[model samples]
Target: MKRDYDIIVAGGGLAGLIVASSAAYYSNQSMKILVIDRNAIPQQGKKTVSGWVCGDAVGKNTVDYMADRIKISWGYPEIEHPVKGVIAYSPDHETGISFDGEGYILNRQLLPQRQLRDATKAGIEIKERVALRSLMVEGNSVIGVEGDDLDDKTAFKKTAQLVVDCTGVTSVLRTNLPIKSFIQRRIDRDDLEATGRYIYNFELAHEDKTYFDSDYCIIHLDQKLAPGGYGWVFPKGENKVNIGLGVQQKAFDTRNRVMGVHPDLKTLIDEYVEVNPVIKSPRLADGAGDEGNAWGTWQVSVRRQNDCLVANGYMLVGDSAWMPKPLDAGGIGPAIIAATIAGKDAVEALQAGDTSEKGLWKYNKHFINDYGYKTAGLEVFRRMLQGLTNEQINYGMKHFLSKMDIDKITKGEHPEFSTVDRLGMIIRGAMNKKLAEDLKYCATINKVLVDHYHNFPETPEEFSEWHKTLTGHLEEAFALYK
Candidate 1:
C-alpha cells in the first residue's frame, strides 16, 4: 500500500506536536507529517490546571527551542508561573518542610497550542475531533492508522511509512500492537496514579492574610487523604492555584470500600479543602464554586521507562511510552526529550530508506541513556516511599532527606551521598531502625538498577538478555517493599 504521508502521529498532545515540530525542524521541512487529535486544540484559558516541574538542563533547552519557534515569551501569565520553592506537609498536617527549587506551574494547554501552531506553520497537517481506533498492520509492521472523524462519524484510513503513538495513558494504538512486540502490553493498575484536580481562585477570609505563599508550591504527604500517593497545591499565578490528590488504584479502591462512599478524587479534594486551614471556602475560577467546576480526573502511568519504545515501522512517545517520572508524576520533560529524539530518528530512518525497528533503534538507545537511567532510581525511590507509613515519611523528611537530595532526584539524577553524608543519615536513621533498613535497601537497589540501565543493550539483538537482567533487578527492588 502506498503511504499517504511520511509520518502519521497519533494524538496531538505535547508529545505529538513536539514530534511534528522537531521532525520539521531537523529535517529542514522535508518530511510530510499529520497529527490527529480526538479533541479540538486547546485555547488559552480552556485548559486544566497542571504544572511541569523540570530543573534539568535538557528540559530547559527543549523549552527554549520551542519557545523560539513559537514566538511566545516563556514565563508567567503567558506560558507558566515561575516557582521558586515547595513546601511539604506531613500526614498529620502538623509538621512541614520547605525546600528551595526552581520550576514552573505551566499553563498546560497554552504551550501545546503554541507548538501546534508552529507545526502547522511548518506544513504539518492536523485534524481535530479525529479519534484513532487502531493501527493498520501488515505482517507485524504498522502501515498506518484507522480512525473516526467524530464530527461526521465517518471512518477513514490514512497510511504512513511510520506511525508514532503519542496518545496518552489510554493509548488505543499501543495496546493493539502485536503481543510479540517488545512494548509492554498494558500498564498495571498498581503502577497508575489516579488524580483529580481543581483550579481555584482563593477567596481569602481576610484580604490581609493569604492562605499560602504564591512563590512556593505545596505538597501534602497525607496518605490518609491521598492514600499511597500525595496531594499538591501548585500556583497557577498569584491568585489561582491547582489543587489535587493522587493515589494508586488499589489503595484508592480499598479506601472507597472502607469509607462506604464512592471516594472519587473530587470527594477527596473537597474533604481536604473544607477542613484544611489554608484553603477554606475557595471559589472556582470559572465562577461555579457552588456547583463545583471540576477540571478533570485522569490516570498517569508512573512505571519505569519502557525498554522498547520502537517496533517495526512504529514508535511510542510521551505517556504512550510510560515516561512519567515516578517521583511526582512529571512527564513533560521526558516527553519532550523523547519526542525530539523520535522526530530526529524518524527523519534519519526515512532518509536511510529503512524504517524498521532496527532502523529506529537509536531512539530507544538514546532515550534509555539520556532519561531512562535516572528514572530507574526515582522509580525505586517511589516504591520505597510507597512502602512507608505516614509517620515514617514525616520523620525521614524532617531528619535525613534534604532539599538538595530531592532536587537532584527530581531532575533525573541520582542523589550523591558522601561518606560524611551517609554517616550522618545513618546516625539519624538509628532513631528509626525500620526506616534505616528500608532506606539502605532502596539505595542499594537503586544503584543496581541505574547501573544496569547505563549498560542497556547497544543493539536489539542483545535486548532479550539485557531485559532478563533488568526484570530481575526490578523484581528485587520491588521486593524491598514487600
Candidate 2:
C-alpha cells in the first residue's frame, strides 16, 4: 500500500513549521501533509538559542498567528529602551554612529513552536525524531521523503506528491536531490566566524510607550584584533541578551584558503570580555548545541549543486532555500515573510492540480521578487563595508550614517533606516574617497543584482536573461574592488 500526501514538508523549523501549519489551516481539507522533524513537537520551552541576532524572531504577522498554547519567554525584561542607534568602535577607539532602525530584540525561540502547534491544529501530522536520511524521487520529480526513525533505528519512507525542503543551511534533503540552484558557496575561515554568546546580568536604558524597546547590534572591524566580521551584542529585553560574532567566510578562507579553521570564537570572546567590562558576559555552559564550541555556532552559505532550487513538484523555503540575507546572514525575517507567502502559493498550486515543476517554481519567483532584492543587494554592501578600515568606516559613517533617518520614522518609537538616505550616503561616501571610488563600480553591479532579484521577470527566457545579466553585473561589481 502506498500512502500519499498532498504535501510533505521536511525539517520542522521556522519555515517548515510555518508552511506546514499554513497548509493545514488554509488548504488542509484535501491536503494530507506530513512533517518529519529530528525533534518532536515544539522547541519553545526546552530549546535554548543563546546568540541569535534578531531579538524578535517572529514578526508581527507570525506572532498574531502563533498558537496560544506555545509559551514565549523573553531573554530580557518585557520593558526597556529601544536602542535608536549604534556606536561603532575603531581600532584606536575611534567611535562612529549607525542608525539602529526601529526593530525589536526578542528571545526569538518562542514563535517556532507556536507556529508548530498552530500547524498541528490545521491537521499536519508530526513524526517525531524522524531524521531524513534521503529523498524519494521518481525520475526527475520528487515523489516523497526517506528517513531513519532515530527513536527506533528503523527506516521509514513517507510519500507525497509534492515535497518542500524547509531544512536549514545543511539542507540534507535538498542537497541529496538533483535540483540546481545559484545558492552554492562554501564558507572559508574569513567567510565564516566563530560565534559565541553568553547571558549575564544586564541593564536597559532605552524604552518607549506600548512596551517596546530597542537594543544595539554592535559591530567592530580590525581583522587581526576583531576577526573577519563584526561583533554584535543584541539586547533581549534588558537584562537578557543575545550577543555573538558574524564574519565573511572568504575573509578567513582567502587569508588562509583553508577550511576547519576559524577564529577561536569563544576563547577570543572570553579574552575580549575580560578586557572590556561593559559587556557583562554569559558563561560557556549557558551556550546551546553539542559542538566543540559548546556554547553556540551557526554556519552560513550552503545550497544544492546548482542554482536549481525549484523543480517539478518541489520548492525549498528558508535556509533550505538559501533565503538568508547574504549581507549579515539574517534569515529570520526573510524566512518568515517568504515562507508565509510560499505556503500560500503552495496551497494555490496544489489546489490547481498543477503541482508540476513549473507550478512549484512560482514560489521561487514570488520569494525572489519579494525579498531577494534586499538580501542580494545587501550582500554587495556588506562586502564593501567589510573591506574598509577604521578611517574608511568613519568616513563612510560620517557621510552616510544619517542617510538611514531612523529617528524620523515611527515617531521616535521605532527608529529605522530609510532606503533613500542609505543610498545617498553610499553615493556621497564613494564620491570622495579613492577606495570608495573603486567600490562604486560594484554599486551598479549590486543594483543589477537588485534589478534581477527585484524584477523576477516571469518566463524561463526572461529569467535566464536577467540571471545572466545579474551574473555579469556581479563580476563587474566585484571586479572594481578586486
Candidate 3:
C-alpha cells in the first residue's frame, strides 16, 4: 500500500511536535512525517482562541528525560522561570507540603515557537491551519485523517502508514474515530475540569511565601475557593506569575448552592486573584512573551490515561489519551513522557512492518509500567481529597501525612499506608476519626491500583480481563468516595 507520509501527526501542539521530533530522531531523520495544526503558522500550536491555555509548569526531570532521549532541550525565554519545587498548601494556609521536585514555569506562547523550530529542523513537514476532524479508517485500522483547511472551506485529506493523535482534551479526531477499540472515545463530564488562568506581572504587597513565591510553585487546596480542584501560583519571572484555578462542574454546582452564589470560572478566578494579599496592582502581562497568551481557559482531564493507547494503525498521545496527573491536573509531565515513548514505539512498530493492534501494543505496556502506574492511584486519592472539607484537609495535612508520604508524593509515587501509620492516626484521637479513616482508605486503595497498573497486560488479548479487574477496583473506590 502507498501512503502520503510514513507518519501523520494529527496535532502540532507540545505533544505532537515533541513526538514527531522523537520519531525523526529515532528513525535517523529518515521517516516522512507531517504535523498538522489548526492554528496559523505564527501561532502554530496555539491551544485555544484565548491563547495557549495551560499551567505551563513541568518538572526538570521530565524535561531532562526528553532531552537525553531526543536531543531536544529548551532554554532561555522558552523555559521562562526556574522553580525549586512545588509546595501545596492546606486550605487554611497554615501548612505546606513539598509536592514535586525542581521544575520550570514555561513561556507557553514562546515554547511553541521553539518546538516548531525543532520539528522543522528534524525534517518533519508542518501544515498550519489544518483542522483534523476525523480519522480515515480502512477495515480495523486508522489510515489517515480528513478535515478542512481553515484558510478556505476546501476539504483536506492525507494518508499515512500510522496516525498519532496529539490533539487536545477535546480532540475531534479522538472522539469521532471510526473504529472499535478500548481507546475511550468520550471522557465523562465528571472527569473533566473547567480551568482558567491569567499571566500577571504584579507588585509585591508583602513577603508572603504562602501566597506568592518565586522560588517555588504554590498550590492552594481550598474547596470553597476551587471546589473539587485547586488554585496555583506558578512563577513566570521575578515579578510575574501564572495564576489559575480548576473546578469540577458537579462540585462547583454543589458549592454554589451551599454558598447561595452563582459564580462562573471567570468570576472565581478574578476573585481569587483579587484576594491575593501579596500581589498588589496585578495587571495582565501582555508584553513580549505574553502576547496572545496572557489569559485563557481550557478543559483538563483528571483521570488515568486511556486503558488502551493503540489499535491497529492508530495511537493516542498526550491529552487525547487523558495523560494528565490526576492529583494536580498537570498534563505537561505525563505528556512529555507519553510522547517520547510513543514516538520510539511507533518507529519500532513501523520497522517491524506491523502497525496492527498486536504489534503496537508495546507502547501501552511500556507507558503504563514507566509512568501510568501511578496515575490511577493519584486519581483515587484526588477523588477522596475532593470530598473533604477545608477543615478536614487542614487536619489531614497536619497530622496524617508523614515524611515518607510526602517523599512518595514528591517522587510521583503512591504513598503506602502501613498498619502503624493507620494506628498512629487512630491514636491521634476521635477529634477527626472520619478524616483519618478516609485517608487510610485512600492510601490502601492507591496501593491496590498502583500494583495492578504495574502488572498491566503485556498483550492486547489479556486487556479485557485486566481492564475488568481495574474497573472493579475503581468502582469499589468510587463507591466508597461517594
Candidate 4:
C-alpha cells in the first residue's frame, strides 16, 4: 500500500525534531518526512500553555553526541548558561556528592524554535496546531495516526509507512495503541512524579553554595521538603535560576499525613523557594525567552524506558517511552541518544522494506547497549533512595560514598559498591547497619539488572524470556523498597 508519507513524526518537541532531522540526514533527503505539532508555528513545540515546563538542564556530552553524529548543535540564547557540574546534597546539608560533569541549563522555550528551523532546513515538512489523538492501526501493525486540527474543530487523519511517537509522558497515542505488543501502554502512578519549577531572577541574599550555586546545579535531598523526590536550583544566568522540586504521590500523601498539612505542588514549591537562603527579592523572569514558561507543573516518569520501544510500523521516542533517567529524572540526555539511534534505525528498516516488529528490533538492541542498559539499575537505586528517611539519607551520603564511588557518579554511572572490601563493609555496616545493608542490597541488585540488560534479546523471538527475567528481578527490588 502507498503511504501518505515515508515517516510521520508526532509531537514536534526536542525528540521529534531530532528524529526527523536525523532521518533526513541519514536518508540523504530522499525520503519524505512530516512533523505534526499541536502548537502554532512560533510556538512549534511549546509543551503546554504554560510553555516548555521542564527543569531545563542537560549534560554537555548529550549535545556533543548529537553534534558528532547529526552535525546539529546549539549555542547562545538557546543554550542559556553552562554549569560546572551537578552537586547533590544530603538532607542535613553536611554532605554533597557531585554526580555529573559539565552541563547546561537550557532556555527550554527557545530551544524548540531553533529545533524547528533545523528540521525545516533538513527538508522535513511540518504541520502546526494539529493535536494527535491515536495511532492508525491495520491488523496488528501501526499504519498512521488520526487526530484533530486545533485550528478549527476539523478531524485530521494521515497514514504513513512509519509513525514516530514523541508525545510527552501522558501521550494519548501511547496509551491507546491498538496493537498487542511489548511496549507498555501505561506508566504506574507510583513511578510518576509531580514536578514543578519557576524561572526567577533574584538578588543574591547570601553567598551560600548549599542554597544557590551559580557554577553548579544544586539538588537538595530533604524528604520533608520534597518527599520521595528532590528540590533543584539550576542556574540559567549569573543571578537567574530555575528552581523546583518533584514529589512522588504516595510519599507526598505520607508527608502530608505526618505533618498535618495539605499542600499542593505550588505550595511545596513556594516553600522550597522561600526556604532558600541565597535567593532574595525574586521575581518571575518571563520577559524574553521565558514568556509563557515562567512557572508550571508537569509529571515525569522516574522509571526506565519502555520494555520494548518499537512495534511494526510504529516507534516510541522520548517521554512517550518513559526515557527519563530514574536516578535524577533527567530526560534530555536519554531522549537525544534514543532519538538519534531511532532515526537511523527507522531509515534502515524502511529501506529494507520490512516494518515488522522483527525488522525494527534493531532500535531496541542498539539503544539498550548505548544507554538503556544502566537505567533499570538506576531505577532500583532511585526506589531505595525514596524509601529512606532523612536521617538515613544523611548518614548514608556521609559515610557510604567513597572516592571510587564518587568518580563513578561523576561519570553519570551507578556506583557499584559490591566490590568494597569485606572488612570495610563490616565496619561501615557496624556504624549504620540498616543503611549499609540497604545500600549493599541495592548495589547487588543494580549489578544484576545491568548484567541482564547487557544480554537483552537480539530479536523479538527471545524477548519473552528475557522480559520475564527482568520482571522477576525488578519485582524483588520493588518489594524491598515497599
Candidate 5:
C-alpha cells in the first residue's frame, strides 16, 4: 500500500515521539505525522517516559505547549522518572554522596505511550512492526522512506514532504546529512561499557505488605563492586522497579558473543535479591554481557564512539544520534534540551515553507551553542578520566573541583576551586604527588570546557572556528593522557 504523510517519523523512541507530539500543536496543522515502533506497549502506556532520568514534569510541559490536547493517538509527552536524583556509593561503602532530592526516575513506558496516544488522537498515525530499511533520497534532498514489517515479510512504502530521521541510533536519513570531515577524531575502546537489565513484576510472599514511596532509584558506583560500570534500581511506582546495570564494554568482548562478561550481572542480581530477604526478582540480567547465563534479560545497552554524525539534510537526536552526556552518557536531560531545539526549528522551517539544507543548519548551530561542541571536549575528558588511577580520580574529585564544585557550578556561581584556592584543601586532602599533576591537568581541561562553552559560536559560520578551538584544546588535553 502506498502511504502518504507530511512527516514519517522513524523509530518510535522518546526522541522520535517527542518531535512528533511536541511539534503537532505549533506546526502547520495540515501536516500529518506517522510514528513507527517495534515492541508493542502493554494495554497501559503512559504518554511520557518514566525512568531515573526522564519524568512526568518533562512530559507534562511538552504536552501542555506542544501536544495541546490529550488523546490515545495524537498529542502528548513521553517518559516519567519519579525518583529524586541519586544516592551514590562505592564497593566498600566508604565514599558516598546523597545528592539530596534531585530528579525523578521516570516510568519509561508510560510517558512515550501517553505522548503517542496523544499524537494519534491529534491526527498522528502509528505504524507498528514497521522498521525503516533505508532512506529514499533524490539528488541532494530526502524524499521519503521504505520500510518492512518487523514480524512479517510485508513491504511498506511511505512518502513524505519532509522526512524526519527520528530513527534513533540507526538513523536512515544521515547519508543526506551534512557531516564535517576535517576534525581529529579519537576513540577509546578500553573505556567502553556494555549494560543490560530486565523489568519484572515483583510479588511479595508475605501478603499485606506495602512498598515505600515507589519512586526512589538506587545507584551503585563502587569500582570493584560493579566494576567497569554501575548498577541502577529505578522505581516506577506501585511496587514496580526497573533494575539494571552497565558493565565495562571491554569486559563483554562482543566479537565472540557466546562467552559471558565479567561480574556476571545475573549473579549480582540474584545475590542482591536474596540479600534483601524481602524483595523478590522475577527477572535477571543476561545479554551479550552474560552470554545467556542468567534468567530473563530485561534490557541491554551498548555505548561506543561515533567519529562524526553531522550531515546536510539530517541531524542526529537522542541515542541514535549519540548525544549522551559525558558524565554518565545520560540522555534524559540532554535530549530534552536538544529535542526542544530540533523540534522547534523544524516546525519554524515548515512554517516558513522552506525545508532546505540551509534552513536546517540552524539545528546544528543551536546544538553547538548549547552542547554539540562541549560534548566534544567533554568526550576527551572522559577518555582522560577513565585512564587515570583511583587516587587520581579521588584527588581530582575532591581538590581541583573542590573550588569549582558541581553544586556551585549548577548555581551559576563562578568556581572558587583553583589550585591556589585548593592549596590547603589539596595539600591536606587526598593527592600525594603522582596524582596531583593529573588533577592540575584536569583543572586545565575544565578550563577548556568553560572557555569553549563561553566562546561557542553565535552563528553557523563560527561553528568551524568553534571546532578548531575545541580540538586544539583537546589536543593539549589528550597529551596529558598516559
Candidate 6:
C-alpha cells in the first residue's frame, strides 16, 4: 500500500494546525503533512469566541516558542485591559472573595486564522470542507483516514505513515478505534462541562450606565443556577464582554430528572443578564443583535482520567486527548504544548521508521509528566467542589478562605496555615460544624490526590500499577463525598 504523505492530520482545529505547522516548520522541512477540515476557513466575525489566561511563565513561553517556529511576524497582542484579578461571589451572591493576578483577553477567531496562514506558508497541505469519516486501521495500528468533500460529497482515501487525531471531543476517528485500544471508549457525562455563552455590546448614556470594573473578571457561583459548575463574565474591552454559565451534565441531568424542573441554560443566562446590576441596557453584538441571541453553546471534557493517548502509528492532541484544565476549562495553553510535543515526536518517529505504539510512547510520557499530573489533582478538587452545597460554599467564602489562598492553590501551591491561622479557622468551624467538616474533608482529599499525581510513573512499564493506584485513590476520594 502506497502512503499519500508522511502524516495525515484529521481535523483542522487549532491543535491540528499546530501539529501540521509545527512539524513542517521544525522538522527541517522534511515531512509531508495534510490537514483536512470539515468546514471552510471561518471569516473574521463568524468564528467562535475564546480567550486565554496564562497562570504562569510556562504558558507564555510555550506560546512564544511555537510562534517563533511558525514564523508569525505579527507581535503578540498585548493583554488588552489587563485584568487586576478575579472576584468570585458565593452562591448567595452576598459573600465575595477577590484574587489579584494578571491575564489577557484574546480575539479567538484571529488567533487560529493566524496559525493557519503560517501553516500554509510552511507547506502543509490543507483541504477545507473535507469531513473525516473514519480511520484507516490495520490490526492495532492506524494507517490513514477515509474522508469526503463536504460540498460535492466526493469520497477520498488518504494514507500516511502516521495519523494524528486533533479532532475535538467528538472525535470520530478516535471513538471508532477498537475498544481494546488505549483510548477511553467514551467520555462520562460527569466529566463533561456543558457551557452556553452570550456576548453582548451595549451603549449606555453616562448617567444610565452601571459600573463594572473592566479591570477584573467576575465569577458567580450558585449551584441552584448552574448545578455542578459556575458562571463567569470576562471583558474583552470596554462595553464588550463574554458572559456564560457552565454545568456538569451529570449533575444537571440528575437535578432535572429528580426535580422535574429542566432549566434551560440559555434562558437562565438571559434572565441573569436582565437583572444583573452591571449589565444595564444591553444589546446583542453584531450578528447576534437581531434576535437578542447568544453567540454559542458547547461542551468539553473537563475531568482528567487515565486513558492511553497514543497507539501504534497514532496519537491524540488537544480535546481529543482531554487536555483542558479541569478547574478553569482552559485548553489553549495545553493544546499548544501538546501539539508541539506531538509534532516533534511524530517527525522523529517517522525518521526512525518506527510508528509503533511503543515508539510513539514518549509523547504520552512527556504530556503526563508536564501537564497531566497537575490536572489530575485539579479534577479531584473539582469533584469535591461539586459535592458542596451553596450554603457550605458561602460559609467558606465568608469565614475561612481569601483571595490569596485561591491564588496559591491555582499556582499548585498549597496554602500554609500558621498555628494562629489554624486556630482562627477552628474557631470559625466551631460556629458551623458541618461546614467545618466539609472543609477538613476537602483539604485532606486535595492533599491525597496531589501527592498521588506527583508520583506518576515515568515509563509505560510502570503505568498499569500507577494507574491502578490512581483508580483506587479516586474511588476512595469519591466515596468520602458519598
What is the C-alpha lDDT profile of model 5 across 250-278, one tens digit per residue? 43333124334334656655545454333
Candidate 5 matches the true fold with a TM-score of 0.73
Tell me which of candidates 1 and 5 scores higher on lDDT.
Answer: 1
Task: Give a tens-digit lDDT track for model 3, residues 1-482.
Answer: 69999999989889999899999999999999999998887887788889889999999999999999989999999999999999999998889988758898898888889998888888999998887788898998999999999898899999999999999888888888888787888999999999999999999999999999999999999999999999999988879999999999999999999999999999999999999999999888889878878889999999999889998899999999999999888899999999999999999999999999998999998898779988887888888888988988888788777788888888887766454365663555464677667777888888788889888888888999999999999999899776
Candidate 2 wrong stretches, greater than 4 Å: 1-3, 28-30, 42-101, 179-194, 202-214, 253-263, 280-294, 302-308, 402-432
Residue-level lDDT tens digits of model 1 in 378-464: 787787777677778777766666566666654556554333246554555453666766676666777888888888877788999
Model 2: ten consecutive residues of lowest lDDT: 408-417
Indicate the worst ten consecutive residues by lDDT in candidate 5.
43-52
Which tens-of-lDDT digit does each residue in 302-332 have in candidate 6? 7773357888888999888888878767677
How do all models score by TM-score?
0.88, 0.77, 0.97, 0.97, 0.73, 0.86
C-alpha root-mean-square deviation, candidate 6: 4.3
TM-score of 6: 0.86
Residues 1-482 of candidate 4 have per-residue lDDT tens digits of 78999999999999999999999989998999999999998887787778788998998999999999989999988999999998999999999988658899888888888998888888999999998888899999999999898899899999999999999899998898889898999999999999999999999988999988889999999999999999999998879999999999999999999999999999999999999989999999978898878999899999999999999899999999999999888999999999999899999999999888998999998999989998998898899888888988887787678878888777667886643444364545343676677778878888899899999999898999999999999998899887
What lDDT would each prediction earn against the true structure?
0.73, 0.55, 0.89, 0.90, 0.51, 0.69
The worst-scoring run of ten residues by lDDT in candidate 1 lies at: 49-58
Whole-model lDDT for model 6 versus the true structure? Answer: 0.69
TM-score of 1: 0.88
**Residue pairs in clash, model 4:** none
Indicate which candidate wins on lDDT.
4
Candidate 2 lDDT tens digits, 1-482: 25478888887776787777666656744588887777655442222243332323223333333332122222233222345444455554555445444444444344455556566667778777777877787776677888788878998888887888876666677656654433343322333343455544444334421111234545455554444566655555455555555555556454343434454556555555454445443443232221222245566542111233567778777766666555445566676666677667788888887777677666767666555555554555556666666566655544433433334211111112233334654455443455545344444555556556666656544567766776676566555443
Model 1 misplaced regions, further than 4 Å: 42-62, 65-78, 92-99, 206-211, 253-262, 287-294, 416-431
Clashes of 4: 0
